[model samples]
Target: MNKILIVDDEPNICNGCKLILIEEGYDVDTAMNGSEALEKLFEQNYDLVLLDIRLPDISGIDILKQINEKRLDCFVIIMTGHGTVENAVDAMKNGAFDYITKPFDDKEIIKATAKALENRTLARENKMLKKQLYDRFSFDNIVGENHQIKEIFDKIQRVAALDSTVLLDGESGTGKELFANAIHAHSKRAGNRFLAMDCNTFSPALMENELFGHVKGAFTGADKTRPGIFEIASEGTLFLDEIANMDMNIQSKLLRVLENGEFKAIGSGKVQKTRARIIVATNMDLKKRVAEKKFRQDLFYRLNVFPIYIPPLRARKDDIPKLAYHFLKRFSRETGKQISGFSDDALEMMVNFEWPGNVRQLKNVVERLVIMSDTHQLSRGFLSDHLEIKRKGGVPDIQTPKTLDELKAAKKKFLTVYFGKIEAAFLSQAISRADGNITLAAKNAGMQRSNFSAMMKKHGIVADKSSD
Candidate 1:
């Protein structure tokens, strides 16, 4: 039950509310004047207060000011027989939750009081959630302790408080998106949503419509009004991932929006403004692309305002051990395995290998080794064959295949080595996995999608089995 305080100069009015509230399971208290109400307020905590404006000693507005000075967390509802709009507005300005005229309905008063309590509860909950999220992914979540990564972290801490356009450049495996998330989390706009979209996912035809929404019947599939990412991400941060893949024509429109913070939706005449901070990521070398005339030079300059380069895993081998241990612990816990730390040999193998696929590949390999290992300790033998290069080991000699003089000869030899059969069986397996879709299968085998087709014809890899 909620505690209620009713303060009014009229004895009949105060007694009536007290009797009704007590009957409805409230711990009701009554006061004849603002002085009495103040005394009662200090003595006991109440959830809601029904205060009469024209009290004998002091007005309700003065009482509210005194209550706010004391910093009590109670919702005040002002009641007055004067019933003037000016009086109601005055009461509202002095921290009153609502203003009710005398002879007000009982249901209306109860509804307003309930709503005030609900608002207080929601306000406290939102504050706590904000605190929790900030603590979880703060600067400490970044894993690397290398010199370059630490420098980047220092720069992030400095720049996060400002409103700047951040450009992240790195290879595909480098964690550019994570850096973008870190920027938003540390920024003043952390409470707002952090929206990310891959610029390459949309085609030229739909790119404009997707970024800036369209109206009903704007095109063939337009059924209703739609809000674009810009509109939805207003007053937030928008991360454009794989920005190098966006079409040339769309780049001009995006650049204009970045300059003026305003853009109109497709098929809409009205202009919309946004205060979103834009962060763009690109794996491709934009300067090279610009010199080649494949990308716009002007747009490149606009996005390169605060460029942050993410060093690849191979460049910072010092952090390899830390990343490996992090992934090892994560994989072990996830798989319900009691895996001890890696052996010295295993650590040596991992730290020496060039991680072409970077941290993502390291994580995948660790998880796989953990699942396959019977013992808790992971040894070098559990690592991938590629990582274990032969050095000064006293192991038994292994048979070596004949060397190939040319690329074609080596490719043919690779097929035989993988399939353990003649050239025909190798071609059959490749084409089969391709589902007769030779280009896709070639890509699956890490070959050029286009070049694979040519190789298939040269090696008799693709054929109509029915014709055979």
Candidate 2:
């Protein structure tokens, strides 16, 4: 049951509200003055407080102030007489939920109480969700002990509090967005939305509309006015992924927003302001793109205000086992599987293989192995065939090879065949996992579709009807 405290100097009014709320299934308490109400609040928690503007001992507005200052988890509804409605409105500005006049209707009071309770419930849920998000993205959750990764963590700690434009530079699947989320979660804007958009996913016009919103009739099929990510993410953080793919015109507009903190919606001449913190991530070298005139130099410098470079999985091989087991545990719980762990040989194979797709590839591989394994522990047999092939095609034993030239020839032959086989297996797995959808396979492998198709063709793997 919901708890409510009714504070009014009039005995009849207090008794009437208490009886009505009690009948509506509330644990209602009545107080004749602000002092009694404050005393009751200090003693126990209440979900709603019906406070009167005119009290004999103390004003109800002062009680409202105390409630806010104490950070009490309760909604205050100001009760006002006919001429005192202005004071009740002022009380609302000071954090009162809604004002009820002296001749309060039973239905009006009940409706206001219901809405306030609903808002209170929503507020509690939002707080819980924010806590969960913060916990999930906390520094403790980032699974890496490498020096470079530790440096990144330190950087995140130092920069998270500052409202600066951050540029995350790294290869795809290096968890740039994860770091971005961590930064936002640790910032003052944690309670607000942490909106993200992939720059490469939309065309120039659509991207413009997505970031800057549009008025109704702005373009074809724009039937309704829409608030863009920038507008919606106001007072929060906006993460732009694959930012190097943003068009030059859009880049110019974005630079203006960063510089002036203002943007005009599409088809609207009126300029609106935004305070959304911009954090951008790019897998490509942005400086190179700027040099090539593909990306704006000004925008590049603007976003580079606070640069954080995340090291790829290959550079931080020591973190592989930890990250692998982390994913294993996560996927196991998610899939309700009880696979214990990986065998030494299986782990060694994973560590030795060049993870071209980086952390994402490793995670996908682990989830696959966990799903496929029916045993207590993962063994080398559970490892990808590519790893086994590479292991078997090792350097030839040259104990009897007397000539240096002959040994060099044997090494070269082994490398050529070994690399060819690895390439074939890698491409085939990517294609097969994508169900022959070349575009999706290329994206998963973090390669251009054309390049992926070329590699597939080099290995004599033809695209089937499923390629569509």
Candidate 3:
């Protein structure tokens, strides 16, 4: 329940306000003077305080000052009589939430009290939300120990303090968005908005409208004027992902903003300005796109001011174990599982295999592992199913197949090599399990010793010649 303190020198007014608030489902207290109000405020926490500007002993403004100095979690509404309205305004400037004039009725008092308490609730929610964002996106939460990763981390720390444009280039799933978020969180604009948009998610026209909002009647569905992210973000940060896919026309407009920090809403002649920092990301080379005339050279140059290249997972194999365990710990707690750790073989599989999708892919695989686990440890079997499928994925960067015969032949060749690898690994593990005895391995696999020996020889795997 919201508790309110009514502080007034007049006994009738203070007690009457207390009764009114209590009847409205609030826990109300009455203070006959400034000293009494300060005493109660220090002894307990109240949601709202109704204080008179003129008190016999200490002034209401003095009590308000003490509350502000103590940083007490309460809202104050100054109560002033006819000639003391100016004093009430001065009291408000000293930290009172609002002021109610004298000769106020029940309706006026209730409205003021409700408005102050509502603002208090909203302020607390906003504070909690900001804390959550800071905790989740802080640089400390990013798991990486590789040299390239360390360098990138150091680079971000330096650039995050600047207002210059940043360009992040990496593979599709290398976590460019995560880096963008970290940059915004560490920047001077951290207290403001951090808005993001995927350039590839919208067409040229829609993308322009989203970046620079439109005036009413600017489009078919226009009902009222709207502020775009550039306006909404104001002096904060704007992260643009997949920027390479942006249309040429939109790129020109973006270049103007980078050049002069000014933009015009669609269908409006008035020019508006923004100081929002730009951070663009892409999985492709913007320089190459500029050469190909698919992207604007001027805009590409502007965006490439501070480039941060994120290394792919294959280039940072050493960090795979740590990244995997990081995801493991996260997913374990989320899924309510007690997964202790991964097996050595499983770790080897994770490190040796190439993650084309990069860190995002590794995180997803760990999530699945957590779901499939029944024991405290994640075994190699759980990983083999996922990695084997990944290993067989993707084709070589050869010419595109045209004829049906060529497509069929390509498929056949791929499956043949794929099965060969699977067979070799299977045979090697079976031999080791059988203590290098081909006879026992053949018996276990329900195959003849001669057939097993022939298979091992064809695969160039030496057999137990002395045994079977």
Q: Write the per-residue lDDT of candidate 2 for residues 1-468, one digit (tens) a residue.
A: 999999998998889888888889999998998889899999999999999998988899999999999999999999898999899999999999999887987888889899999999999998988899899999899999999999998998899999999998887678888999999999888989999998766779999999999999988888999999999999999999888778789999999999989999999999999999999988767788888888998888899999999988899999999999999999999999998898999888888777756787788778777887788788876675323234443643334456888888767755655666677778778866864455778999999987987886454444321110
**Colliding residue pairs in candidate 3:** none
Ranking by TM-score: 2, 3, 1
Provide the lDDT at 390 for model 3: 41
Q: Regarding TM-score, does 1 or 3 come out ahead?
A: 3
10 residues in a row with least lDDT, candidate 1: 459-468
The total number of steric clashes, by the backbone 3 Å criterion, in model 1 comes to 0
Clashing pairs in 1: none
C-alpha TM-scores of all predictions = 0.71, 0.78, 0.73
lDDT minimum window of 10 residues, candidate 3? 459-468
Which 10-residue span in candidate 2 carries the lowest summed lDDT?
A: 459-468
lDDT (tens digit, per residue) of candidate 1 on 352-423 = 887655666676677778788889898886674323243344232234546545656656544444433344
Per-prediction count of colliding residue pairs? 0, 0, 0
Q: Which candidate would rank higher by lDDT, 2 or 3?
A: 2
Cα lDDT for residue 322, candidate 3: 91
Query: Candidate 3 residues 1-468, lDDT tens each?
Result: 999999999988988898888888999999998888899999999999999888999998889999999999999999988798888878878888999887889999889999999999998886776677777877678888889988988998999999989999886678888888888877777778898898766768889999999999987888899988899998899999888778888889999999998999998999999999999888767788888898998898899899999998899999999999999999999999999999999899899988755777788778888998899988887786555444335432234679998888777655645676678678877866774455678788888978887886544454322210
> In terms of lDDT, which candidate is strongest?
2
